[model samples]
Target chain A: MAETRQTELAHADSRESVTPLGPVRRSRDLRVYLVVLGGVMMLADLSFIFWVAPTDSILGDIQRVFYFHVPIAVMSFLAFFVVFVASIVYLVTRSPAWDRLAQASAEVGVVFVTLALITGVIWARPIWGVWWTWEPRLTTTLILWLIYVAYLMVRAYAANPNQGARYSAVVGIVGFVDVPIVYYSVIWWRSIHPSPVVGPLAQANALEGTMAAVLLFSFITFLILFVFLVAQRMALRETEDRLGGIKSAMRRRAESVF
Target chain B: MVLVWKDILLEVRSRELVISVLVFGLLVAVVFNFALDVTPQRVTAIAPGILWVAFAFAATMAMSRAFVREREQGGLEGLLLSPVSRDAIFLGKALTNLLFMLLVEMVLLPVFAVLFGFSAMSFTLIGTIVLATLGFSLVGTLFSAIAAQTRSREIMLPVLFFPVILPVIIGAVEASTRAIGGETTVGLGRWLPLLAVFDALFLVICPWVFSFVVEE
Candidate 1:
């Protein structure tokens, strides 16, 4: 255990030294990627949001919200699936790297989920004539939001660092399972929300050509941004771990000197 | 099975968890009476929800005691080190909790009925309560085990539990609503199957996940 600790300390120290001047060498490529990807999403959000979709009388121009809303919701679900997959991988391999990946993805999933909820409400206010309704889709989304928020809180307030990862990983796995149940329960319970768009092919064919292109482009744009966010967050987490190690080392050094 | 009996025996001797849950449940019923301003006609409609809320709240209190006592007496680690399977530990604890919750529910049912002027002796209502409580206790026990590891465990248990088990509560209350209102077929048709499904799912999943959460 002592030898392993020493090697871990040395590895972290060397990585820190190599990236001392820049914003941490580990995150450099990821940061550049995120900046570029974020720029692409912003452009897409501006262009297709107004230009692509036809407006309905009841919904007004607020149908534009679908461009940003649907993509974020889809990406959030995808991000959580990654968290679930990574959690299973971590449990099987007992690898800290997989745990970090799961944690990073969960954090990004929360961000996108929040954006989904906000944009959803924005769309609902005009379309449904209410800011919030206990409609099945809305209710399930709210529950999903609560679950992920609780996930974040569990990790934040956990007293024992080692136990935190394991406990939160289990939560990540179970929480992901709940997502599908939530989706289906809404349908099963029979609320006012519209049914899912069905198959990808049917969904694509339903949209106008330009609208389909724009929506697909926005989806790709958000996917890239999601990856970039995960990478950046993982790099920051690595830096925080290094700083924690350094603090422990400093404490040990002071104790030895005294 | 013998280990599960041992847990019941321990609880019978101590009476700490059972007494506390029973009293807490009664208090919740009393509070709901004044809060909801229950009239005779409305009582049947509201009784099912009140019963569940009281039971759920009291169960949260009871579950906090589930592992804390073991931890305080230094029994948990010793239990883990024993030859018994971990699932046995989970089963024992969960069964014990189920019994305690039922004991509380048994008392609360009559008191709530009398206070609100409703009948508690109906067979269908009894069946719905049994199914709902079983599902609640099963999931509650699992979450209690998970929360026992955390720092603010008492608060943590409910936070982790309520959202996960909301579907169970919904199914139970809906079923109980139908049963209490004398709509026997509707109660069994919709809620009973849901309750059974929830119970089955938790019983299978919780034991598999318990070992992971309980590891030090």
Candidate 2:
């Protein structure tokens, strides 16, 4: 299975050499587009959040953090969802690429989750008067973060690459499935986190017009950033794999010479 | 059934796994006693948490030991070489782990009651124990198999086990606290169903995943 994949990857690599404007150029173009689009959207989101959106009658300026905070939280979920799907595929096919993708998405998801937790704490300080609360959403997010952290540790500490991929894929899928249960348990157990502000049951015009638009804009921006980071991370993993192959080849050659 | 009996009989003969786990569980309860200054009034309030924590840790110890004998003695290969389906192997190992955990719980519960100065041996509490143990052993056994094959099995099992089983711990702790507090129907009503849901879900999922894991 691995040999076939390596040969297929090598074939694709050779094909990239033959056509100057093939997948390589297209991927490069996509990367550029993602970066540019994400940056522009972020700037627009910042402006709308800081200057355009009406200040909350209750939370004042601090509520602006929700624009970025909620979106980062959403994007983190998206990243982990990708990891979950990729992990299932990897388990079924035993393909190295899917494992790489799962690892990349999980790493990126952890970063975004960290940012979400930090922003959440910052937002909570003036509003809730505490830097931390055992509220449902925050607690669930913390557990989610821990779950992925464990996922990454499994990948890092496995006995071999094959073992790592196989084990971590299982962890990834299991961890993702556990997320909803964690959320449900926390919510049912106790809930102090703010209820949804923009959903159907939200207060009358709680997030009207500019606030909703800014939130939407921020979500799109973070989505783009998520894609860009996962792509960069996956490419780095591929390079590492290629370098590992070369190092093993050199060791084999040295042993043959001896 | 044969495989399950084989594991149980083997455990009964050696007696090492249950002895160590029971002792460890007692020590945990004792440590918790010294660690927390429990007022008489608060004993019932905090007893459930302490008991469940002890059980959770002891279960980890037992689960980590689940496949060690098999892996070391090449008994797992012998089992695999049999005509038994992979699901049977998983069921057998899970049942053995469950039994080991329950044996420790049997001793741990009475010790916990005496040490903490409370007794709530209601059927609801017993039912909760069974359900929680089922959930723990179900997933814990599978992770034990996967971790036993790794470079650092001891550290890997808890790292994988705890995070995955967080819901179980939460559900069990809540339900047991209620059951012990004497709110029989209401207490069990909320948390017991959670345990049932988790156990049922993992009951179907873990064995399927175990087959894939042990195949390699």
Candidate 3:
């Protein structure tokens, strides 16, 4: 209990230090709301995946990865879209909040993209008979991953924090623009990846009614997860900003004492 | 306009940028001869890819040096402090870089043809080169400025650049391959628009963001 109290004091102290830059007025209730909503959606998605969605006619149990895989892929794209919008806003307004949002979404997007790629590889193993192929979708996602990875690296290596934010905002905007080009370039060439299931060209009734419901549940769950993860990451960014402020303050104080 | 002319005149007087890029590009093509072990007959099939790889690398080399002259001469800050807008500086530098790259490419093309024996001098091939080079220089110049401020400026430029420009390279190679293979009009028809679109997007976006980058 004493240890817990000490930890709480440290947290409060850090939070206080962040106010010099204007406290990140993050809504605790909003975070709690997202976490609760995500938990509920996750439970519903798992239930549907196990109990409602039928086994694939061709691929059987292994094909179940699709229910989680496709939704996460969609969420990853959404996350990058957020990064693009946030980057633009940051550039226009020069607001640290938007930069924080952009950076947070990009980091979360990488995680989602990684999960999608792993699930994609697993799904490909039994079906495509290979662990990986340069399919159009796979290749585009890989490039997207690389661009954002470079974005993060630029931010990490920049000479100054402010300059890094400016540089990364530029990268974030440019990198997002490449996504559609990567997609179109690959699509124009050739693709071994499966065609869309819900588009105009999709097969009639490719998804059964129950399967559609489960997939929808998965998408909702993943969207909630995306929101929760981004908020959590944004909060961590605030804490970091606060700690940096506190460290510089302490250094200034030490110099004066000397 | 004045900035652009200044850059051009500076290059004209020194002749360093064009000469180095041209020699380096030609050397790369020659090296590809021994590296790939291409038989004369197979040159038509592989020449486009080799040419693009060489151009891409050569363009990167020239771009890494884009701001080094200004930085070395201690003129970057004076330019930034001048009444000219940041966009003008970017434009001036980009135009000069574009001219230098095209000069290198124009000379490299004949040399490449002589070396590879691949007849890569058609109208369609020229069109593809122009479009590809425009996009290359625009993106390269912007990244060159960004990388110049970093510790590992030379290395950072390529690492930050090549992946972003992969689509341009693919489009150029595919189009140039078809053009060299005698499908000139059809190949140009297919890929030229894609390259044009990429160039147009960067032409507008890079300058807008460049001011932000150079400011702080």
lDDT of each: 0.75, 0.82, 0.83
Cand. 1 Cα-lDDT: 0.75
Report the Cα lDDT for residue A189, model 2: 67
Rank by lDDT, highest first: 3, 2, 1
Alpha carbon deviation, residue B11, candidate 1 (Å): 2.9
Candidate 1 interface RMSD to the true structure? 1.9
Per-residue CA lDDT of model 1 for A128-196, tens digit only, reads: 567776656667778777777777777776776567777777777766666555555444454323443
Across A1-258, the per-residue lDDT of candidate 3 in tens digits comes to: 699556655654665575543444545568888999899889988988988899888768886898888989889899999999999999999878898899999999999999999998898777767788776788898888888887887888789888888988988988888789878877665532344322212322488888888888888889889989999888889778777776676556558759
Please estimate how well model 2 matches the true structure, expressed as its whole-model Cα lDDT.
Answer: 0.82
Off by over 4 Å in 3: A1-26, A191-205, B9-16
Q: Compare the candidates by lDDT and give the number of the best one.
A: 3
After TM-score superposition, the amount by which residue A114's alpha carbon in candidate 2 deviates from its true location, in angstroms, is 1.0
* DockQ comparison, 1 vs 3, better candidate: 3
Report the candidate with higher TM-score, 1 versus 3.
3
lDDT of 3 at B6: 80
Model 3 clashing residue pairs (backbone) = none
Q: In order, what DockQ does each candidate have?
A: 0.50, 0.66, 0.62
